[model samples]
Target: MVSRILVPAARTAAAARSGLTMRSIVRGFQTSNVVRQEAATVVAPVKKPVGAFRGGLFGFLLGATASGAGMYYYVIDEYRVSNELLTEDIYALQTAVQRIEGYVRTLEEKVHSKKK
Candidate 1:
C-alpha cells in the first residue's frame, strides 16, 4: 500500500518538472525572436563627414580668439596701473634720498665749525 502511494507522488513531481522546463524553453525562443524583429526594424546606419568635425573645431577656435582678446586688454590695463604705482614709488624714494643727503651735509658743517 505504501509503495503504490509513493509511485504516484514521484510521477506527479516528474511531470511538474518537465512542464517547467518546456515553459522556460518556449519563453527563451520567444524573447530571441522579438529581439531579432526589433533589430531589423531599427534605423539605417549613416556616416558623419569630416567637414562637420572641422567646422566644430573652427567655431571653438573663434570663441577662444575672442576670449583671448578680452583677456589681453584686461592684462594691459592692469600693467598700466601697476606701472603708474611703480613710478610714484620711485619718485618718493628719490625725494627721501635728497632729504637724507641734506641732513648729512648739515651735520658735517656743524662738526667742522666746532673743530675750527
Candidate 2:
C-alpha cells in the first residue's frame, strides 16, 4: 500500500528531474530501436485493370501473327515441293527431246545413203 504509492511517486519525481522521456529511455536500452520516428500516412498507388478492348486487340494481334507465320511456312513448303516437281518434269522433257533429235539424225543419214 504505502510502498506502491511511494515507489510510483518517487519514480515520477526522478523522471520530472530528468528531461528525457520514458520512450527515449526504452529506445536507448533496445538494440532494434535506434531512431525515433512518427507514424506516417501510407498511400499505395494502384494501376488500372486492362480493358476488354485492349485485351481483344492483343489477342487479335497474337492470333494474326501466329496464323501469318503458319501460312508463310505452308507457302514455303508448297513452293519447295512444286519446284522439285517442275525440275523433274524438265529433266524428263530434256531426255525426250534428245531421243527425238537422235531419231531425226538417223532418218537424214538413211536419206543420204539412198541418194548416194
Candidate 3:
C-alpha cells in the first residue's frame, strides 16, 4: 500500500518539475525586435487614373455577363418544364393507343363469332 501511494506521488512530482523547466526554457528564448528609423521622408507611388472609356467598357462587360448568366438559368428551367409536359403527353398517347388496341381485339372476336 505504501509503495502504491508513493509511486503515484513520485510520478506526479516528476511531471510537475518537467513542465516548469520546459516553460522556463521557452521564456528564456523569447525576444523583442528593435526597429530603427533612418529615413524621415516617405515616397508616394505613381498610379494611373481610369479614363471614361475604360470605366464605361468595364461596366458594360459586367452588365452583359450578369444578364447572360441569368438568361442561361432561365432557359434551363424552361427546358425542364417543357420536357415534363412532353413526357406527360407521350404517356397519355401510350395509354390511348393501348385502349384502342383493346377495342380492336373485341371487334375481331365479335366478327369471328358471327362467321362461325
Candidate 2 wrong stretches, greater than 4 Å: 1-47
Give the alpha carbon lDDT tens digit for every residue of 72-111 in model 2.
9999999999999999999999999999999999999999
Q: TM-scores across all candidates?
A: 0.53, 0.60, 0.59
Report the alpha-carbon TM-score of model 1 versus the true structure: 0.53
Candidate 2 CA-lDDT value: 0.78
Candidate 1, residue 75: Cα displacement in angstroms equals 1.1
- Local error of candidate 2 at 77, Å? 0.2
- Cα RMSD of predicted structure 3: 16.3
Model 1 error, position 77 (Å): 0.6
Top candidate when judged by lDDT against the true structure: 1
Model 3, poorest ten-residue lDDT window?
A: 31-40
lDDT per residue as tens, model 3, 1-116: 44335455566577677774323332234333432233324457878999999999999999999999999999999999999999999999999999999999999999999999
Clashing residue pairs in candidate 2, if any? none
The residue-level lDDT of candidate 3 at 52 comes to 95
